[model samples]
Target: MTAGLLAPPTLIRTTRGRAVVLGLAAVTMAVEMASLVVGRSIHIGSQPLSASVLPGLVLLAALGAPSVGRAGDRDRLVPFWIAMAAGLLLGVALLSRTGDLADLLGLVVAAANEEIVYRFAVPVVLATALMVLRVPTRAARVAGYVAAGAWWVLLPGHQAQTDGAVAMVTYASFAVISTVVVARSRALIPMSIAHCVLNVITIAHLRGDITSGGRGALSACLLFLLVGTFAWPGDRPGRRAAATDDGDQDLVTDTVIDLRDGQRPSVHRGEDLTWVDEPSEDDQPEPVGAPGDRRSANHGPPRH
Candidate 1:
């Protein structure tokens, strides 16, 4: 059991694994819909748990499942740390103002639950299904991301209850951005932290901790700036270097194979794919005689 838990995500390559992922996705949607019909949150003391059991399970499965393509290559933690700092600030601000431990706990749990469902599980399963069906990688990924965002926007009862067009648009945009970030990075850690921060800000605003729209707007801008800066591409130097090395190695291997198979190997040196030809023995220059011997022979001939 311990070995299985630690095993690589090779199972996701199998048809069975794909089926399982898809099944989990279906179950997650069903449970979320049911939760909407019933109560969205279950209160246990001051902390309320979002009814996201299936979605949470799906996240756990994704953690263990093997993914196709470059899923493993994109897990950067720096952005998550930045987001965590922002979340801590939000939490601190809320606690300082309200002194309500229940609200704080509820915000944390809600944020985590929402991210696990909409950002991690739903997208992973949808993308995995698309990949199994041999969809183009980028298209599949984009489709999965859009699907997750749509799920959040269309299915949630709270979102439906939100008043005004501006508020709805703002909420949708926030969900979409969070989904895109998680999809592109293929890591939930950063998104979870970011979501927590957003939730705290939202709850605080709703609770009147933030008196005006201006302060809320400022907080939102700062949060976006922090997450965006840290999550920007090439931010993790080590991961970028590793990806570059892997790509270079793959290119070299492909070139070698093509050469061995008597095919013209087009090597991408810089921007151009230039064909390289193997040098033959006849192409090599012949050895020349030493200067002293050549001079002596020439002088003797001149004398004769």
Candidate 2:
């Protein structure tokens, strides 16, 4: 199957969607940076809402990302909660190693803002563009992250410290890991929040809340907790209720995925992971023979 078919529907499914989100991010980023040029010192971020966060928040709201945990989507919440836990743990663990920290809340907020723009927005838009160009899904995902990772290291002079050969390699490795996470989780919020935590801990240190040799202790306990979100309790990741097409044989497996943006009833096969839209009643074959006929016994072509 083509990557176009496997492509998960994101907020940027269409060019218009991409344009709107990327455009908004651009405007917001400009405004945020311009603040530093002027007299406002909000560049370091603030307690509740920072200038950096405004753009990300507005874009997220526009894209309906926060709706992932709504009543209809409760089953998809495991990944989100697990992400939060992993982020918190990672934050505390890094404190002992990191030195000369910035404002904890400010750093967290700034990182969260970066998560929205770098981790979520750029990848989604870039991946969508690549898919539209018929690029392979895996390549598209990897390429999509180049901008985010590069921006984190290249754009701001502050990130130059992490630009050594080793750091570059690590960042590249992380890009791959995060690409896989985005593919599997299919939800931006989890990845975004997780990224925010990852970015800040090195600078903020557990929200700058506590201190101890617990650093080693916390470091030892820095379990990723990402694998825990592979599927819901007793729920396989790829399994879906079979959709009998009345003329085809389907071999679905034991994996369940929660698609982004609440698109319902997409069928995923084993490792291929191809997504097929649910067949409408009109698409089903008409009944054969007469009533009481064995061939005609598909429940009369499945009522609407």
Candidate 3:
């Protein structure tokens, strides 16, 4: 309603791609939100249904949005490490409160659902709308990140009251960090895993698993950050990455999925059809009769 009513007539008529993207964005949001109810009956045998994955699956079936919230191999590790740091702060903030198993489960479900809402749906729709209104792609995306984080902090049933309003600033900071990572990677897995790990860490403290209490949990979180930061594979395969002088860290998403076309083109390096106009030296097949060719044709002795 906000988009259609207020959209400039000039833009509405002048721009067609924006309209298509906007329509796609709307459908993506609607499908994800509606699936929250319709997906209740979605079951996969004995294991509990991961409602978090349902919206993504529905997008796949209805819209053919294969890349939505899905990670690519080249997605960077700095953002992921940042996500874990944010989750660590969140777990530490929750230490003062009393929580049980039910709370732990509740946190997990909330993390999943809220990520879809704040990170997945909100960014998609908002960015498209902003773009339709003449905002540049990068600025609109930044605004979307801010909007998602704001809602994450302000939403009543979500992260707002998680700490009894004690660390509201911490919650706000966490929201910002979470949204930025999600937007940058265009994948929910990093934030999702970090958040779930945080849930377990919090519950472990509450359940006496961490014998030294918050201190032990803090140690665990720190240790995780250390190992994951050093061990994380941030670079694309067949590439080596060091922090460059120009800050060339691959921070943002590589491909954009348009629901109108529904073509999730594989943009993997060296894999996609459009990866090269002509094969590189490494990609060139060996010449059969060339001296240096590894698979040169066997000599015909009868020719002598």
Q: lDDT of all the models against the reference? A: 0.54, 0.46, 0.47
lDDT by residue for model 3 (97-151), tens = 6433344445555555566556655676776566556565567667876876786
Q: Evaluate model 1: give its TM-score.
A: 0.59
Model 2 spans > 4 angstroms off = 1-41, 44-52, 66-102, 127-142, 155-158, 199-223, 230-304
Ten-residue stretch with the least lDDT total in model 2: 247-256
User: Candidate 1, overall lDDT?
Assistant: 0.54
**Candidates ranked by lDDT, best first?**
1, 3, 2
| Number of the candidate with higher TM-score, 1 or 2 | 1
Best by lDDT: 1
How big is the positional error of residue 230 in model 2, measured in Å on the Cα after superposition?
5.3
lDDT of 2 by residue, 148-173 (tens): 65665453433465657886665665
Ranking by TM-score: 1, 2, 3
Q: Which is superior by TM-score, 2 or 3?
A: 2
Clashing pairs in 3: none
lDDT of 2 at 71: 18
